[model samples]
Target chain A: MSKTLAIGPFNDAERAALSDEFSPVFLAKPDELAGLTDDQRAAATAVAYKGHHAFGAAQMDLLPNVGIVANFGVGYDAIDVHAAAARSIKVTNTPDVLNDDVADLAVAMLLMQCREMEQASAWARSGNWKSKGEYRLNRKASGGTVGIVGLGRIGREIADRLAAFKMDIHYFARSEKTTPGWQYHGDPVSLARAVDFLVIALVGGKDTENFVSAEVIEALGPRGVVVNISRGSTVDEAALLDALENGKIAGAGLDVFLNEPAIDDRFYKLDNVVIQPHQGSGTVETRAAMAKLQRDNIAAHHAGKALLTPVN
Target chain B: MSKTLAIGPFNDAERAALSDEFSPVFLAKPDELAGLTDDQRAAATAVAYKGHHAFGAAQMDLLPNVGIVANFGVGYDAIDVHAAAARSIKVTNTPDVLNDDVADLAVAMLLMQCREMEQASAWARSGNWKSKGEYRLNRKASGGTVGIVGLGRIGREIADRLAAFKMDIHYFARSEKTTPGWQYHGDPVSLARAVDFLVIALVGGKDTENFVSAEVIEALGPRGVVVNISRGSTVDEAALLDALENGKIAGAGLDVFLNEPAIDDRFYKLDNVVIQPHQGSGTVETRAAMAKLQRDNIAAHHAGKALLTPVN
Candidate 1:
């Protein structure tokens, strides 16, 4: 077996662990792979991948012996699975490990938004509560209607947590699920129309690009809050921003966004929105689990065993 | 029958509803009662009270015919229940109605604190995610050990919601109840020692003041978070602030403080602490429910019926 290439800027501990197991060559970016000598390229048979940097055929071609790409996150959108499959290369992603963290974040954002906790916290943090009297009463989050855009694993987890708060769970999926007491709407618009919160948990790909459209956003109306823990591509960012700017919708709690790290400047100006740095799975415990799963798949590939969570 | 007095700064709708049913004399402060004529004071048979100002026997004596003191909130520590009982005055408080909102806030605050949502939100808002890399990984909130200081109505609600997240629930109450699967500790220190999060849901009063003392705070150890949604008096605020400041404990999610609105300024300096303006039940729906319940109790007192949620 050839040596492994560890890509992306992992923490010191993760990097040390990767080096200890695989005796890997480290590269922060895929583009740097081209700079490696022919011997180094030939030695790279597997890659431990992290970050949102695109890993396509070009990068794979640089490592001629690369047989497997193990991604650190549940979503492998940045990795070209089709390209990997065509090159007889295996692809594996760490899933299920991050479901709890993402689900917790989704629930936290929804409750924080609906309850106006951000402002309430700020009011208390400042001396305003003493001078301004009690914080203004906001909406009750519990026992309200919540419509999930997709009822996949992560979505199901989100719904499960929300259900504990006595919320009415509505979901939009291609096929109805067997979850009792949960309402299933045929389309996104109908789902949006039926709920006070629209939480997006759809998988990321070309097919899901702008899955939550203008019509769906409009259907959610003024009382609705849009919470997105899935890819920003799943939502029509322009439409969502316009609605929020004009008071067409109540607010949003967004983690992922289009062109993130440099998301739309307008979002910062809106007090109704709560912005998170695409950190749904950015927890020490969850990241450790994801890293472990990624390493396990890489170890399996090296051992000539079946991949634990293969995508391609 | 004498008239009912609607005291405190009520919203227009609440005032209108109170006036529509009972001939209510509105007073923004208890001191304002002295301005009323002797006949006006004599005509007051019931009081719909709000605000944190002390309502002792002195204020109660102002209304010689006052039959019932209906408090708008669950905690009636501000009202002298002993004085009410001594004067044969019926006292009622609105409980259970606000449990859902308060519990929702407790969960929200805990998740928010453990997730480092305050810094995460600021990073995204300031466009730092683009300038900087991924936000540093924070602690996982779900599936962690949580110790409840009191297993009262609100504490039980908090525990119930946390159970949905698959947390290990341990509780400190006077006596262990018949709750299956949840571990019960006889004391606060032992409970704090075993859990990653210490959530205070004990009732506020002299008996429970500083219920979570320095010893309990120390027992929680590092990596432990303290979430208080009950009242300011339940926990030793000085000890909590010291623990947070000195990094003795991890963090805290406080909805109540020792002197809220004017709480210890030291708390404002800590990045790990999440503060709220005593907004455990400050939701429009829950507050409306509480107000309605208060009115109902006052109405019951006038009709010679039993008080709905009598405290004295």
Candidate 2:
């Protein structure tokens, strides 16, 4: 009888690692938890969770003895912490470890858009450069003003990298941060207006839904580019599409989208946009670290020890 | 009769700028110099050259009165500086102005390859991310060691940017430079062995035709990534392709290729390569700066003043 259920699609190596410590029952999705036999369900003392699926009270009820949910990712928006706390269930998340990878991707996406690297790379591969003369001139990325939509850990990481490129950094958070020479904006609209590139690094969920509104998109103007590495809910997709279509704004380099993998098909046809499948922390080193942290949390829970990074 | 022959396909703005100082005769190529009327040839005191066409003594002879060849780009390998100096023809090139743009592209290409962003972006756009669970895991780029070939001005710029990402900097130059904390290797193979990324920033021409040889490529090994923002001839393309095809070297992010536009078609089919069409300095702001520098040299030559950025 297993004391743990490792939910979500783990790669072969990750699954092997989990099996070493727990007599784990693997479930790729939370919906599958209800389908487990009573014996399997009753035996579970903890859940090592992954994926961006909602894990609420209904799922919690299915595994009554599952005292803790150890999430693989830093963000726990998918897991309802309040619901977990209500059921006397503890929730823990992996944080800080994946910050560099996420921050690296945000800046990479921004550079891709600013320099039009996608088109240039494609042109070279297709043997177009020889026949077509030279790749078209792109805008310079460095030495420009950049606006970050949040100043949390991930946002600060991004700002630090861009600063090395000689960029002037401006950011918006609930309140001001104490970083030297970094300008703080009270609202996102003004931040967008003052900078050439706007990067969104806000936390996911309801409060940040459409945080980058149509007015903010409009304020970004023709020379503006938006780079989003956070959840898709942070930006208004409709307004962003309109701005890109009409050339109201220059371009965007997006990692996450609303209903991703099933993202807006219009993004496919746009040359101005560089769309990446939400892969901020998809690097092998980072993923391995995330998986290890998640396993460590579950190990702690099973031992009746304090969780390494508890959420609720 | 023109006092200057703008010997490349100049844009409307660039041509207008040239006309401000000289009786500009616009030629899209250097070969067209042979077709010029005697009076037009005799009137030309300076040539504002662009493109990668060989402007040897043969081309120089077409304009007997030409005193200066003011090349648009920093690299004057095509201009044959020794040939120009032999004919008592002064050579000047636009340098330093394009350094930041090239450095930015080099780092961007490295990030794109490390994250496998091209395929990931395509998957998101193709609606595969929705159907498929997630993008494949890729290697981490930040906090790794990077080796620079020929740590000149542009190499220094690339090193500075990568350092901000917490990357360890290593380089090979004729003589070790005085950069603090950056390790200098006396040999190319040692440099390649020491770092995950090998960036080529060597000056072009016969002396550097195959500076990154098969030995260095082999030394880089399977985990190594090669980023070339220098001239294509700087690397042994055949050895590079073989390594990439055999999985001997992990991948390449190349901005330059031998016979570019007509480069090896094998590169097109390779998923492990990021082929950029030699657009290192192909940014609007940088190109404008380069054009200004080229014009400044031309202006200096006509005024019997010393050249602004003289090569000989």
Candidate 3:
């Protein structure tokens, strides 16, 4: 008998493409698994989510024969990897494919904040057109300092984009990287002091929890701008608020927050900051490419080919 | 027996520099001529205004010995050249020194508007950070069409900058000239249809009055952006307002306006536009350079040498 794979928050194209090779069963609802017989459920091998929160390991428990949970994004934090590991079900995440797109946003945020483009636009709209005098011209990105907190794939790509602007690049990494044109610092504090724009690209975990605190923010000085593209847990939310309120740091461009969808109201009132919802890899072109990579990874794993991006 | 020069509205540094060369009579007000005796006023050889709105030629005739009106900036439209010519007074303007600075602003405005950096920042600050998830990714400037109106010194410099972005460049001029890397269009309407970004670099005058009308704007289509660094008279305000309101054109970035220091309030409400208070060459570094060039032009004329930028 052929193995059955449960699929979907239902991407029609991904489902059709997968059905060409496997006997695919479309799971429309979480409760529908209760109706499946033991033997039928045991025949399922792989599962994918069409919706944001559908593809967790607990959902995989409905299918006894499930071997892999391939996620459609670089972030698989929502997936309980430990639960899958206990069940001997492999979890795969799409990475590196979305690096350029996220890096483009990071640089865009930095430029927007430093240049004060938002405030300038507001001033233009306010009937102060004739009275609107010259704006405060900040230092250009070209030949300026740019510091990165993490030296991972995305962080490195951000460095490469800033390099095109002729910026001096620096990074804080656990170990020294021999990349040309990048100065590696021992810690985040040291990195903040050395640069005018500090970008946070570190992974979220116990070691990186609250890595950017009041001390590090203070070290960035009054004219520095902080851009966080990583998880909100890596930064001290209260300290950032205090620093921003007191003008300890010049401004910030945040893509992630401590309590997303319930962000602090103070960040909204400040004209100096730039904020975006966690859209690091949210571009249509980049997301589609990521989904395809995830699909290919599952197919390659089942065929016993070398996995594209293996975590464990 | 030394000739005097009336210096109006110059900064301290410019005044000090002029004091070294001539017997400088600082004109505190337009009516300050009343302070001078007939012989003292008659000894004046030249008059200068740092900013626009210098007195008319009627005031210049008060000083019968005056030979030139050396303006600080490139634009002398406020100065009545016909009246100066009637009294046989040569007029000189400082140009070429401000081309690169103004061109830099024009490009920066274009990039900021297309990227929607202002709107993104506002959304972030409005406590709707999650809405940023829906931001439309910007089209790359590389391999895009750039249209230049008034192919002069600054327009050419804008073309030079666009070369780095890998844009296909075209221009609309009164007469065609053989310039490599630029295809010349016969008129503004044709240029509007040919490019994604239409940049206004034409001078403001009767010859070029309302050069960008409703017809030209209508031809630009919905995805087009207008970047104006030239005088406001080059564009019809009513046509621009109509296009912006109806979404016929995507957006605009304007530095000069029809009635400057008295801008319309409607421009303030649009998220698609960027407005500056006529600060094209307002940078401290660039302004200092401009002042030095103006002084050099005056000294060159005084020495009976060729004027640096004589009004033809």
Model 2 DockQ class = high
Weakest ten-residue segment in model 1 chain A by summed lDDT:
A1-10
lDDT of 1 at A220: 99
In terms of lDDT, the poorest run of 10 residues in model 2 chain A is A124-133
* Local accuracy by lDDT, each model: 0.91, 0.91, 0.74
Quality of candidate 1 docking, DockQ: 0.87
Model 3 docking category: acceptable
Q: Return the lDDT, model 2, position B111.
A: 93
Tens-digit per-residue lDDT, A1-312, candidate 2: 899998998998899999987869999899998789999898988999988889898899898888999998888888988889998999999898898899889989989998888888877766677787788899999899999999999999999999989999999999999997899999999999899899999998878999999999999899999999889999999999999999999999998888866788888889999888889999989999998999999989888888999988
Off by over 4 Å in 3: A1-108, A131-143, A148-191, A200-216, A230-237, A279-312, B1-108, B129-194, B201-216, B264-271, B280-312
Residue B84 displacement (Å), model 2: 1.9
Q: What is the DockQ of each candidate?
A: 0.87, 0.81, 0.25
Encode model 1's per-residue lDDT on B1-312: one tens digit a residue.
348998887887688888888869899988898898999999989999987778889999998999899998999888899999999998899999999999999999999998999899987777678898778899898899999999999999999999989899999889989785899999899999999999999888888999999999999999889999988999888898899999999999998887767888898899999888888898889888998999999989889998899997
What is the DockQ (computed on Cα atoms) for candidate 3?
0.25
lDDT of 3: 0.74
- In candidate 2, what are the lDDT values of residues B1-312, reduced to their tens digit? 778899887887788888887868899898888888999999988899988888998999888988999998989999988888888999999999999999999999999999999998877766778787689999888898999999999999999999988899999999989997799999999999998899999999999998999999999999999999999999999999999999999999999989866888899889999888888998889999999999999998888988899988
Decreasing TM-score order of the candidates? 1, 2, 3
